[model samples]
Target: MGPELPAALRAAVEALLEGASRKDLARRSAQVSNTYRGGGSSATAIVEDADATAYVLSRLPATYAAVAAALDEVRVAAPDFAPASLLDAGAGPGGASWAALEAWPRIAEARLLDASPVFLETARRLAAAGPAALAGAEMRRGDLTQPGEGWRAADLVVTSYALAEIPSERLEAAVRGLWAACAGVLVIVEPGTPAGTARVLAARELAMREGAMVLAPCAHQQACPLAAPDWCHFAQRLPRGRDHRLAKGADAPFEDEKHAYVALARPDVCRAAPAARVLSPPRAGKPGLEFRLCTPGGIERRFVARRDRAAYAAHRRLRWGDRVEDA
Candidate 1:
């Protein structure tokens, strides 16, 4: 299961949909989806306020769930990380900011940056009814491909689903800017597709080369264990409400947002990497449970037989996307 959208945030989003034509919103939603599926970015797809509204109705919850899940791993790796300021780069309607506030309530300041004016204004509207920090947060419009004016350092910096939009040549510079602004932890989340995983891996490598420590997903900073045709990713299942269903023209009550992420900290930060990360759903059998894990050594499959009562009981409830010290 994944985290649900905060009640206040949900209500605010629903209010935005009021008086808008559902038919129009659905059409815009389709256009946005098609653009993204075709390797386009929201900067071009979400041009108008209505398009931004449609995005909130159709994608906000899932994006929030994915960011929250990725931030949870950051929390696990850095329990003492109590960030006071947050920077949500490429923030669309402030979903990542909301998710960050939920994870770190003590955060006193938030800054959202995006390339779309519609999304920035929509984010402000939605944040008006959100937590105090978010409601009064600064909203700025900036393109990721362009050189930033040296962003202020924040305790936590997140760029979710925005890296794919940068041209290949400019991506390294974009990541450098993000790392430059991060004071505590940096979390990068992308769609769960193989292409998304490749972006995350590239960022991970660049960050490490710049003296960043790997915090989650990988216990060791060695090369990714999973080879081509098999990429690293995780799923977060979020509930879809009536407005969400209507805007997306779907009947399903929920959607699984598959995401690839990397959480890294400054080299001075302590490392709390897991021993192994469960790569897929565990297989249950009369004998025991089978797990596919990414370990310090490499990708390996382990089986815990029922005869091993202690280990079996300890892992009976293990699920996919779970990090384990023993696998």
Candidate 2:
């Protein structure tokens, strides 16, 4: 499992659930999930305050966990990146903003934009119980699919699980606009399905053309190695609170959020690229261990035999999404 929710955020969620109707929340959550799974837009999916609150209770934790994990990889790629400002486009319930604040304490200014007034209002209420930076966050109601002027560029820009909601025809323009608003790094995250991977891949290409460098999940700016039958994604497990379990109608104590994300930074940001990234869990066997790595050399299936004691020992510690210098 990944890191647990920050204390303040957890407390705030718990408080929100205190007076909420579990049954209604569960029903609404299911509806929202179905809508997204069917490629429906969220602009009308979350229509009421209750619907927005349900989304916060049911989906916020997983989204936060996924973004947090992605941000950790960003830190690994650029340790010196201490963003002073953040712009969370499509910041539903402000989950991405909270994750950004947790990842970069230096972030002093935060701007959250979403089209849904109810979501923005709920985000504000949730931010009230979060860190001081979020308590005074600038929440704006705007459509991210359309580019607007006068929005200040931030040191870090994040759009989590938001790109998939955009219409296919306008996605390229949206990606470009987000890149234009990014002064430092821009991270985009989506569901781990093939569709999600497609969005991330498309955005990656646009970012590269816009002069941004790939920072995670790819060792090179070349085409993706995985083909149609396969997609690139990672999973982060997070403990499910009682409210979350009830809202999702799940019996599992924890939920694994599978996500596809791409992190890109300004061309001037100097950082060493990982020789490869472990695409899946290392397989242990009688002979030794095998890993599927996405390397600068291309996709490779490497094996470290038990006879190679030192190499096998180091390989034992490897997990999915790890950056490897060798092998």
Instruction: Give lDDT tens digits, candidate 2, residues 3-100.
Output: 78789988887777778779989999999888878878777679998888889888898999999999998998988888998998999899889888
Task: List model 1 lDDT by residue over 138-170, tens digit each.
Answer: 998887666465268899999998998988899
Q: Please report, in order, the local distance difference test score of every candidate based on alpha carbons.
A: 0.89, 0.89
Q: Which residue pairs show backbone clashes in model 1?
A: none
Per-model TM values vs. the true structure: 0.97, 0.97
Where in model 1 is the C-alpha error above 4 Å? Answer: none
Error of 2 at 289 (Å): 1.0
Worst 10 residues of 1 by lDDT: 143-152
